[model samples]
Target: MFKKAFFAGIPVAILCLGLLTGSCQSTGTNKRDKEGFTAIFDGKTLQGWEGDPTYWRVEEGALVGEITPTTLLKTNSFIIWKGGTPADFEFKGSFRITTDGNTGINYRSEQLTDIPFALKGYQADIDGKIRYTGQNYEERGRTTLAYRGEKVTVNTQQNAADPESFRANVKNNAWQARQVTGSLGSSDSLQTFIKSNDWNDFHLIIKGNRLLHYVNGKLMSDVTDNDTVNRKMQGLLGVQVHVGPPMKVQYRNLRIKQL
Candidate 1:
Protein backbone atom coordinates (compact mmCIF):
# COMPACT_ATOMS: atom_id res chain seq x y z
CA MET A 1 0.00 0.00 0.00
CA PHE A 2 2.90 2.43 0.68
CA LYS A 3 4.47 1.63 -2.70
CA LYS A 4 1.16 2.27 -4.44
CA ALA A 5 0.84 5.67 -2.69
CA PHE A 6 4.30 6.75 -3.80
CA PHE A 7 3.51 5.95 -7.47
CA ALA A 8 0.23 7.89 -7.32
CA GLY A 9 2.02 10.95 -5.84
CA ILE A 10 4.60 10.85 -8.66
CA PRO A 11 1.92 11.33 -11.31
CA VAL A 12 0.38 14.27 -9.42
CA ALA A 13 3.76 15.99 -9.11
CA ILE A 14 4.41 15.57 -12.85
CA LEU A 15 1.05 17.15 -13.71
CA CYS A 16 1.75 20.10 -11.40
CA LEU A 17 5.13 20.71 -13.03
CA GLY A 18 3.57 20.69 -16.51
CA LEU A 19 0.92 23.17 -15.46
CA LEU A 20 3.56 25.56 -14.11
CA THR A 21 5.55 25.42 -17.35
CA GLY A 22 2.47 26.21 -19.43
CA SER A 23 1.67 29.23 -17.26
CA CYS A 24 5.19 30.58 -17.65
CA GLN A 25 4.97 30.47 -21.45
CA SER A 26 1.67 32.27 -21.90
CA THR A 27 2.87 35.87 -22.07
CA GLY A 28 0.95 37.02 -25.20
CA THR A 29 2.31 38.06 -28.61
CA ASN A 30 3.30 41.65 -27.94
CA LYS A 31 6.91 42.32 -28.82
CA ARG A 32 9.58 42.68 -26.11
CA ASP A 33 7.15 41.45 -23.45
CA LYS A 34 7.89 44.85 -21.94
CA GLU A 35 6.57 45.28 -18.46
CA GLY A 36 4.85 48.65 -18.80
CA PHE A 37 4.18 49.49 -22.44
CA THR A 38 0.62 49.52 -23.80
CA ALA A 39 -0.24 48.29 -27.28
CA ILE A 40 -1.79 50.96 -29.48
CA PHE A 41 -2.65 48.86 -32.52
CA ASP A 42 -5.16 46.02 -32.24
CA GLY A 43 -3.71 44.33 -35.40
CA LYS A 44 -7.22 43.86 -36.77
CA THR A 45 -8.80 47.27 -37.10
CA LEU A 46 -8.13 50.99 -37.24
CA GLN A 47 -10.21 51.51 -34.15
CA GLY A 48 -8.11 54.19 -32.43
CA TRP A 49 -6.61 56.10 -35.33
CA GLU A 50 -7.85 58.39 -38.08
CA GLY A 51 -6.58 58.82 -41.64
CA ASP A 52 -7.72 59.07 -45.22
CA PRO A 53 -9.36 55.76 -46.09
CA THR A 54 -7.93 56.16 -49.57
CA TYR A 55 -4.40 55.70 -48.31
CA TRP A 56 -4.59 53.63 -45.17
CA ARG A 57 -5.95 50.24 -44.14
CA VAL A 58 -5.35 47.12 -42.08
CA GLU A 59 -3.77 44.24 -43.95
CA GLU A 60 -2.21 40.97 -42.91
CA GLY A 61 -1.95 41.93 -39.26
CA ALA A 62 -0.24 45.23 -40.07
CA LEU A 63 -1.31 48.84 -40.63
CA VAL A 64 -0.69 49.44 -44.32
CA GLY A 65 -0.62 52.69 -46.30
CA GLU A 66 -0.54 52.56 -50.06
CA ILE A 67 -0.58 55.25 -52.70
CA THR A 68 -1.03 54.50 -56.35
CA PRO A 69 -0.50 56.80 -59.30
CA THR A 70 -4.17 57.64 -59.36
CA THR A 71 -4.20 58.12 -55.62
CA LEU A 72 -1.27 60.54 -55.56
CA LEU A 73 -1.50 62.90 -52.61
CA LYS A 74 -1.80 66.63 -53.09
CA THR A 75 0.03 67.10 -49.81
CA ASN A 76 1.45 64.82 -47.14
CA SER A 77 -1.13 62.87 -45.12
CA PHE A 78 -1.14 61.08 -41.79
CA ILE A 79 -3.06 58.56 -39.70
CA ILE A 80 -3.38 60.40 -36.39
CA TRP A 81 -3.65 58.44 -33.19
CA LYS A 82 -6.70 59.42 -31.17
CA GLY A 83 -5.15 58.26 -27.95
CA GLY A 84 -4.19 60.91 -25.43
CA THR A 85 -1.40 63.24 -26.50
CA PRO A 86 1.75 61.94 -24.90
CA ALA A 87 4.13 64.41 -23.28
CA ASP A 88 6.98 62.05 -22.49
CA PHE A 89 7.06 58.53 -23.83
CA GLU A 90 8.87 55.66 -25.49
CA PHE A 91 7.40 54.45 -28.80
CA LYS A 92 8.38 51.41 -30.84
CA GLY A 93 7.14 49.71 -34.00
CA SER A 94 8.23 47.65 -36.97
CA PHE A 95 8.09 49.21 -40.44
CA ARG A 96 8.66 48.33 -44.07
CA ILE A 97 8.70 50.55 -47.14
CA THR A 98 8.71 49.92 -50.85
CA THR A 99 11.57 51.18 -52.99
CA ASP A 100 9.73 54.32 -54.04
CA GLY A 101 8.01 55.15 -50.78
CA ASN A 102 8.81 57.48 -47.91
CA THR A 103 7.16 57.70 -44.49
CA GLY A 104 7.71 59.09 -41.03
CA ILE A 105 6.43 58.59 -37.54
CA ASN A 106 5.22 61.96 -36.34
CA TYR A 107 4.82 62.76 -32.66
CA ARG A 108 4.18 65.82 -30.55
CA SER A 109 2.27 67.08 -33.54
CA GLU A 110 -0.95 68.97 -34.24
CA GLN A 111 -3.54 68.28 -36.92
CA LEU A 112 -4.25 71.01 -39.46
CA THR A 113 -7.49 71.36 -41.40
CA ASP A 114 -5.75 73.26 -44.21
CA ILE A 115 -4.59 69.86 -45.40
CA PRO A 116 -6.89 67.06 -44.34
CA PHE A 117 -5.29 64.46 -42.08
CA ALA A 118 -2.11 66.52 -42.03
CA LEU A 119 0.22 66.66 -39.03
CA LYS A 120 2.77 69.26 -38.02
CA GLY A 121 5.65 68.58 -35.60
CA TYR A 122 8.48 66.18 -34.87
CA GLN A 123 8.91 63.22 -37.25
CA ALA A 124 11.04 60.09 -37.11
CA ASP A 125 12.11 60.06 -40.74
CA ILE A 126 11.76 56.81 -42.70
CA ASP A 127 12.56 56.19 -46.32
CA GLY A 128 12.96 53.09 -48.44
CA LYS A 129 16.21 54.48 -49.81
CA ILE A 130 17.61 54.67 -46.28
CA ARG A 131 18.42 58.33 -46.76
CA TYR A 132 16.65 59.66 -43.67
CA THR A 133 15.75 56.70 -41.51
CA GLY A 134 16.03 57.28 -37.74
CA GLN A 135 16.45 61.05 -37.91
CA ASN A 136 14.61 63.83 -36.11
CA TYR A 137 12.65 66.15 -38.38
CA GLU A 138 9.97 68.68 -37.60
CA GLU A 139 7.12 68.72 -40.06
CA ARG A 140 6.37 72.23 -41.31
CA GLY A 141 8.58 73.53 -38.52
CA ARG A 142 12.35 73.48 -38.01
CA THR A 143 12.98 70.64 -40.42
CA THR A 144 15.86 68.20 -39.94
CA LEU A 145 16.61 69.07 -36.34
CA ALA A 146 19.00 66.12 -36.18
CA TYR A 147 20.20 63.69 -38.82
CA ARG A 148 21.30 60.10 -38.49
CA GLY A 149 24.21 59.43 -36.12
CA GLU A 150 24.05 62.93 -34.61
CA LYS A 151 23.75 64.27 -31.10
CA VAL A 152 22.46 67.81 -31.33
CA THR A 153 21.61 70.65 -28.98
CA VAL A 154 19.64 73.29 -30.82
CA ASN A 155 20.15 76.82 -29.43
CA THR A 156 18.52 79.23 -31.81
CA GLN A 157 19.68 82.18 -29.76
CA GLN A 158 23.34 81.29 -30.17
CA ASN A 159 22.88 80.34 -33.79
CA ALA A 160 21.22 83.68 -34.49
CA ALA A 161 23.78 85.76 -32.59
CA ASP A 162 26.69 85.03 -34.90
CA PRO A 163 25.57 83.05 -37.89
CA GLU A 164 28.86 83.29 -39.71
CA SER A 165 31.00 82.49 -36.69
CA PHE A 166 28.75 79.62 -35.69
CA ARG A 167 28.91 78.22 -39.18
CA ALA A 168 32.67 78.44 -39.24
CA ASN A 169 33.01 76.80 -35.83
CA VAL A 170 31.03 73.75 -36.86
CA LYS A 171 31.99 73.79 -40.55
CA ASN A 172 33.67 70.39 -40.59
CA ASN A 173 31.56 69.04 -37.79
CA ALA A 174 28.39 67.48 -39.29
CA TRP A 175 26.45 67.66 -36.06
CA GLN A 176 27.43 71.27 -35.21
CA ALA A 177 26.83 72.26 -38.82
CA ARG A 178 23.19 71.85 -38.00
CA GLN A 179 23.79 74.04 -34.93
CA VAL A 180 23.87 70.86 -32.87
CA THR A 181 26.58 68.64 -31.33
CA GLY A 182 27.55 65.04 -32.11
CA SER A 183 27.49 61.71 -30.28
CA LEU A 184 27.40 57.97 -31.00
CA GLY A 185 28.99 56.67 -34.23
CA SER A 186 29.34 58.42 -37.59
CA SER A 187 26.58 58.69 -40.19
CA ASP A 188 28.30 56.09 -42.34
CA SER A 189 28.10 53.67 -39.47
CA LEU A 190 24.42 54.46 -39.02
CA GLN A 191 23.67 53.68 -42.65
CA THR A 192 25.10 50.23 -42.15
CA PHE A 193 22.70 49.59 -39.30
CA ILE A 194 19.59 50.43 -41.31
CA LYS A 195 18.07 47.61 -43.37
CA SER A 196 16.51 49.14 -46.43
CA ASN A 197 13.49 47.49 -48.10
CA ASP A 198 13.11 45.11 -45.18
CA TRP A 199 11.28 45.06 -41.89
CA ASN A 200 13.15 47.03 -39.25
CA ASP A 201 12.48 48.27 -35.75
CA PHE A 202 12.26 51.99 -35.08
CA HIS A 203 12.20 53.46 -31.62
CA LEU A 204 11.80 56.90 -30.16
CA ILE A 205 12.29 58.06 -26.59
CA ILE A 206 11.15 61.55 -25.77
CA LYS A 207 11.38 63.28 -22.39
CA GLY A 208 10.82 67.00 -22.29
CA ASN A 209 13.26 68.71 -24.66
CA ARG A 210 15.46 65.68 -25.13
CA LEU A 211 14.73 63.12 -27.86
CA LEU A 212 16.47 59.95 -28.94
CA HIS A 213 15.90 57.92 -32.13
CA TYR A 214 17.06 54.42 -32.81
CA VAL A 215 16.91 51.87 -35.64
CA ASN A 216 17.43 48.16 -35.15
CA GLY A 217 18.96 48.76 -31.73
CA LYS A 218 21.52 51.26 -33.06
CA LEU A 219 21.46 54.82 -31.81
CA MET A 220 20.71 57.06 -34.78
CA SER A 221 20.14 60.55 -33.45
CA ASP A 222 19.88 62.37 -30.12
CA VAL A 223 18.64 65.94 -29.73
CA THR A 224 18.19 68.37 -26.86
CA ASP A 225 15.92 71.11 -28.08
CA ASN A 226 16.74 74.46 -26.45
CA ASP A 227 14.61 76.46 -28.83
CA THR A 228 11.98 77.10 -26.22
CA VAL A 229 10.05 79.43 -28.46
CA ASN A 230 9.40 76.83 -31.15
CA ARG A 231 9.96 73.40 -29.63
CA LYS A 232 6.74 71.53 -28.96
CA MET A 233 6.22 69.95 -25.53
CA GLN A 234 3.37 67.65 -26.45
CA GLY A 235 0.73 66.93 -29.06
CA LEU A 236 -0.78 64.26 -31.31
CA LEU A 237 1.01 61.31 -32.89
CA GLY A 238 0.73 60.19 -36.53
CA VAL A 239 2.35 58.30 -39.38
CA GLN A 240 3.00 59.95 -42.71
CA VAL A 241 2.31 59.12 -46.34
CA HIS A 242 4.72 61.45 -48.04
CA VAL A 243 3.66 63.03 -51.33
CA GLY A 244 5.92 61.58 -53.92
CA PRO A 245 6.22 58.60 -56.25
CA PRO A 246 3.56 55.95 -55.72
CA MET A 247 4.48 53.30 -53.15
CA LYS A 248 3.51 51.47 -49.99
CA VAL A 249 4.52 51.35 -46.33
CA GLN A 250 3.46 48.99 -43.58
CA TYR A 251 3.69 49.29 -39.80
CA ARG A 252 3.13 46.70 -37.07
CA ASN A 253 3.71 45.83 -33.44
CA LEU A 254 3.25 49.38 -32.16
CA ARG A 255 3.55 49.94 -28.43
CA ILE A 256 4.20 52.93 -26.23
CA LYS A 257 5.19 53.63 -22.64
CA GLN A 258 4.43 56.98 -21.07
CA LEU A 259 7.35 58.48 -19.16
Candidate 2:
Protein backbone atom coordinates (compact mmCIF):
# COMPACT_ATOMS: atom_id res chain seq x y z
CA MET A 1 0.00 0.00 0.00
CA PHE A 2 1.83 3.18 -1.20
CA LYS A 3 -0.40 5.48 0.83
CA LYS A 4 0.17 3.55 4.06
CA ALA A 5 3.97 3.49 3.54
CA PHE A 6 4.16 7.28 2.95
CA PHE A 7 2.17 8.02 6.09
CA ALA A 8 4.37 5.67 8.17
CA GLY A 9 7.47 7.68 7.17
CA ILE A 10 6.04 10.96 8.56
CA PRO A 11 7.03 10.25 12.20
CA VAL A 12 10.61 9.39 11.19
CA ALA A 13 10.93 12.59 9.16
CA ILE A 14 9.71 14.71 12.08
CA LEU A 15 12.16 13.05 14.46
CA CYS A 16 15.07 13.83 12.15
CA LEU A 17 14.02 17.49 11.92
CA GLY A 18 13.82 17.79 15.70
CA LEU A 19 17.32 16.38 16.11
CA LEU A 20 18.73 18.92 13.65
CA THR A 21 17.05 21.82 15.40
CA GLY A 22 18.65 20.90 18.71
CA SER A 23 22.09 20.59 17.14
CA CYS A 24 21.98 23.96 15.45
CA GLN A 25 20.75 25.75 18.58
CA SER A 26 23.36 24.12 20.78
CA THR A 27 26.33 25.14 18.65
CA GLY A 28 24.99 28.33 17.05
CA THR A 29 26.47 27.76 13.58
CA ASN A 30 26.12 24.48 11.81
CA LYS A 31 28.79 22.57 9.88
CA ARG A 32 27.76 24.07 6.55
CA ASP A 33 28.24 27.61 7.85
CA LYS A 34 31.80 26.76 8.92
CA GLU A 35 32.84 25.28 5.59
CA GLY A 36 35.43 27.86 4.61
CA PHE A 37 36.49 28.90 8.09
CA THR A 38 39.58 27.48 9.75
CA ALA A 39 39.69 26.78 13.46
CA ILE A 40 42.14 29.01 15.35
CA PHE A 41 41.73 27.17 18.60
CA ASP A 42 42.62 23.48 18.68
CA GLY A 43 40.12 22.72 21.49
CA LYS A 44 42.86 21.16 23.62
CA THR A 45 45.67 23.65 24.14
CA LEU A 46 46.69 27.30 24.04
CA GLN A 47 49.37 26.63 21.45
CA GLY A 48 49.49 29.79 19.38
CA TRP A 49 48.23 32.35 21.90
CA GLU A 50 49.87 34.77 24.30
CA GLY A 51 48.49 36.22 27.51
CA ASP A 52 49.14 36.64 31.21
CA PRO A 53 49.59 33.17 32.63
CA THR A 54 47.79 34.21 35.79
CA TYR A 55 44.42 34.65 34.14
CA TRP A 56 44.12 32.55 30.98
CA ARG A 57 44.12 28.84 30.39
CA VAL A 58 42.67 26.08 28.23
CA GLU A 59 39.90 24.19 29.92
CA GLU A 60 37.30 21.71 28.75
CA GLY A 61 38.02 22.31 25.09
CA ALA A 62 37.64 26.04 25.39
CA LEU A 63 39.88 29.04 25.90
CA VAL A 64 39.04 30.19 29.41
CA GLY A 65 39.83 33.46 31.15
CA GLU A 66 38.99 33.63 34.82
CA ILE A 67 39.61 36.27 37.47
CA THR A 68 39.55 35.18 41.05
CA PRO A 69 39.19 37.57 43.96
CA THR A 70 42.84 37.29 44.81
CA THR A 71 43.85 37.65 41.17
CA LEU A 72 41.59 40.56 40.28
CA LEU A 73 42.84 42.85 37.58
CA LYS A 74 43.41 46.58 37.94
CA THR A 75 43.31 46.96 34.16
CA ASN A 76 41.74 44.88 31.47
CA SER A 77 43.89 42.13 29.94
CA PHE A 78 43.73 40.10 26.74
CA ILE A 79 44.76 36.77 25.27
CA ILE A 80 45.98 37.57 21.79
CA TRP A 81 45.97 35.17 18.89
CA LYS A 82 49.31 34.83 17.14
CA GLY A 83 47.74 34.47 13.73
CA GLY A 84 48.07 36.76 10.74
CA THR A 85 46.23 40.07 10.73
CA PRO A 86 43.01 39.80 8.75
CA ALA A 87 41.91 42.88 6.86
CA ASP A 88 38.58 41.76 5.45
CA PHE A 89 37.25 38.70 7.14
CA GLU A 90 34.42 36.79 8.78
CA PHE A 91 34.95 35.44 12.29
CA LYS A 92 32.66 33.09 14.20
CA GLY A 93 32.97 31.90 17.76
CA SER A 94 30.88 30.63 20.66
CA PHE A 95 31.12 32.19 24.11
CA ARG A 96 29.79 31.67 27.62
CA ILE A 97 30.20 34.12 30.48
CA THR A 98 29.48 34.32 34.16
CA THR A 99 26.74 36.59 35.50
CA ASP A 100 29.19 39.44 36.25
CA GLY A 101 31.73 38.78 33.54
CA ASN A 102 32.64 41.16 30.76
CA THR A 103 34.59 40.19 27.67
CA GLY A 104 34.99 41.05 23.99
CA ILE A 105 36.73 40.20 20.75
CA ASN A 106 39.09 42.85 19.40
CA TYR A 107 39.96 43.02 15.74
CA ARG A 108 41.89 45.54 13.69
CA SER A 109 43.42 46.43 17.05
CA GLU A 110 46.84 47.38 18.28
CA GLN A 111 48.58 46.17 21.39
CA LEU A 112 49.51 48.95 23.80
CA THR A 113 53.19 49.57 24.38
CA ASP A 114 52.95 50.33 28.08
CA ILE A 115 50.43 47.72 29.17
CA PRO A 116 51.29 44.13 28.43
CA PHE A 117 48.47 42.21 26.70
CA ALA A 118 46.48 45.42 26.32
CA LEU A 119 44.75 46.31 23.03
CA LYS A 120 43.13 49.45 21.65
CA GLY A 121 40.71 49.25 18.78
CA TYR A 122 37.23 48.15 17.71
CA GLN A 123 35.72 45.48 19.93
CA ALA A 124 32.65 43.26 19.64
CA ASP A 125 31.27 43.79 23.15
CA ILE A 126 30.03 40.80 25.16
CA ASP A 127 28.95 40.58 28.76
CA GLY A 128 27.34 38.04 31.05
CA LYS A 129 24.39 40.40 31.24
CA ILE A 130 22.96 41.12 27.80
CA ARG A 131 22.94 44.89 28.42
CA TYR A 132 26.19 45.68 26.61
CA THR A 133 26.30 42.51 24.59
CA GLY A 134 25.92 42.84 20.82
CA GLN A 135 27.39 46.34 20.78
CA ASN A 136 30.39 47.75 18.95
CA TYR A 137 32.78 49.28 21.48
CA GLU A 138 36.14 50.76 20.63
CA GLU A 139 38.11 49.73 23.67
CA ARG A 140 40.75 52.24 24.73
CA GLY A 141 39.71 54.09 21.59
CA ARG A 142 36.44 55.79 20.61
CA THR A 143 34.38 54.03 23.32
CA THR A 144 30.85 53.14 22.19
CA LEU A 145 30.69 53.36 18.43
CA ALA A 146 27.25 51.76 18.13
CA TYR A 147 24.94 50.26 20.68
CA ARG A 148 22.85 47.19 19.97
CA GLY A 149 20.19 47.79 17.30
CA GLU A 150 21.93 50.97 16.10
CA LYS A 151 23.36 51.59 12.66
CA VAL A 152 25.83 54.44 12.64
CA THR A 153 28.53 56.18 10.69
CA VAL A 154 31.42 57.69 12.66
CA ASN A 155 32.72 60.97 11.26
CA THR A 156 36.19 62.35 11.79
CA GLN A 157 36.95 65.21 14.15
CA GLN A 158 39.14 68.14 13.21
CA ASN A 159 41.55 67.38 16.00
CA ALA A 160 42.22 63.71 16.52
CA ALA A 161 42.42 63.33 20.28
CA ASP A 162 43.58 60.41 22.38
CA PRO A 163 41.17 57.88 23.85
CA GLU A 164 41.26 59.42 27.28
CA SER A 165 40.42 62.88 25.95
CA PHE A 166 37.58 61.50 23.84
CA ARG A 167 36.23 59.70 26.89
CA ALA A 168 36.44 62.90 28.88
CA ASN A 169 34.50 64.75 26.21
CA VAL A 170 31.82 62.08 26.17
CA LYS A 171 31.48 62.20 29.93
CA ASN A 172 30.94 65.95 29.80
CA ASN A 173 28.49 66.06 26.91
CA ALA A 174 27.61 62.40 26.11
CA TRP A 175 28.38 63.23 22.52
CA GLN A 176 30.54 61.92 19.72
CA ALA A 177 30.73 62.64 16.01
CA ARG A 178 28.73 59.57 15.12
CA GLN A 179 25.38 59.83 13.30
CA VAL A 180 22.67 57.22 13.75
CA THR A 181 21.58 56.32 10.25
CA GLY A 182 19.13 53.50 11.07
CA SER A 183 17.95 51.03 13.65
CA LEU A 184 17.94 47.22 13.70
CA GLY A 185 15.64 46.84 16.70
CA SER A 186 15.23 48.15 20.23
CA SER A 187 18.07 47.18 22.56
CA ASP A 188 15.64 45.62 25.03
CA SER A 189 13.87 43.62 22.37
CA LEU A 190 17.14 42.21 21.02
CA GLN A 191 18.10 40.86 24.43
CA THR A 192 15.24 38.39 24.29
CA PHE A 193 17.11 36.41 21.63
CA ILE A 194 20.27 35.97 23.67
CA LYS A 195 20.56 33.04 26.02
CA SER A 196 21.32 33.77 29.69
CA ASN A 197 24.22 32.00 31.47
CA ASP A 198 24.80 29.84 28.46
CA TRP A 199 26.85 29.55 25.32
CA ASN A 200 25.96 31.98 22.55
CA ASP A 201 27.13 32.36 18.98
CA PHE A 202 28.94 35.56 17.93
CA HIS A 203 29.93 36.50 14.42
CA LEU A 204 31.91 39.50 13.22
CA ILE A 205 32.02 40.46 9.58
CA ILE A 206 34.60 43.18 8.89
CA LYS A 207 35.24 44.68 5.50
CA GLY A 208 36.87 48.01 4.70
CA ASN A 209 35.13 50.74 6.74
CA ARG A 210 32.12 48.61 7.61
CA LEU A 211 31.76 46.25 10.56
CA LEU A 212 28.85 44.08 11.60
CA HIS A 213 28.22 42.19 14.83
CA TYR A 214 25.77 39.31 15.05
CA VAL A 215 24.62 37.17 17.94
CA ASN A 216 22.89 33.84 17.52
CA GLY A 217 22.18 34.54 13.85
CA LYS A 218 20.71 38.00 14.61
CA LEU A 219 22.45 41.16 13.51
CA MET A 220 22.77 43.31 16.61
CA SER A 221 24.98 46.26 15.60
CA ASP A 222 26.21 47.75 12.39
CA VAL A 223 28.85 50.50 12.12
CA THR A 224 30.69 52.24 9.35
CA ASP A 225 33.70 54.33 10.29
CA ASN A 226 34.13 57.18 7.88
CA ASP A 227 36.80 58.71 10.12
CA THR A 228 39.97 57.84 8.26
CA VAL A 229 42.18 59.48 10.87
CA ASN A 230 41.23 57.08 13.69
CA ARG A 231 40.11 53.95 11.85
CA LYS A 232 42.38 50.93 11.49
CA MET A 233 42.53 48.97 8.28
CA GLN A 234 44.11 45.90 9.81
CA GLY A 235 45.87 44.81 12.98
CA LEU A 236 45.86 42.15 15.68
CA LEU A 237 43.05 39.98 17.06
CA GLY A 238 42.49 39.25 20.73
CA VAL A 239 39.96 38.38 23.42
CA GLN A 240 39.69 40.28 26.68
CA VAL A 241 38.92 39.85 30.36
CA HIS A 242 37.60 43.12 31.63
CA VAL A 243 38.66 44.94 34.77
CA GLY A 244 35.81 44.30 37.13
CA PRO A 245 34.55 41.90 39.77
CA PRO A 246 36.01 38.40 39.75
CA MET A 247 34.43 36.72 36.76
CA LYS A 248 34.95 34.13 34.05
CA VAL A 249 34.44 33.86 30.29
CA GLN A 250 35.12 31.09 27.81
CA TYR A 251 35.42 31.03 24.03
CA ARG A 252 35.21 27.91 21.93
CA ASN A 253 35.33 26.99 18.23
CA LEU A 254 37.04 30.17 17.10
CA ARG A 255 37.12 30.04 13.32
CA ILE A 256 37.85 32.68 10.71
CA LYS A 257 37.51 33.10 6.97
CA GLN A 258 39.41 35.93 5.32
CA LEU A 259 37.54 37.74 2.63
TM-score of each: 0.80, 0.84
Candidate 1 structure quality by residue, lDDT tens digits, 153-223: 88754553355654443432232425656668878888998887899998899998999998999989999
| Model 2 lDDT per residue over 100-200, tens place | 99999999999998877899989999999888999999888778889999999988866666756565546422238789999999999999989989999
Query: Every model's Cα RMSD, please?
Result: 15.3, 14.3
The CA lDDT of each predicted structure is 0.77, 0.81
lDDT of 1: 0.77
Where's the lowest-lDDT run of ten residues in candidate 2? 1-10
User: How much is 51 displaced in model 1, in angstroms?
Assistant: 0.4
Q: Which stretches of candidate 1 lie over 4 Å from their true place?
A: 1-33, 158-178
- How many collisions between residues are there in candidate 2? 0
Model 2 segments more than 4 A misplaced: 1-34, 161-169, 172-175
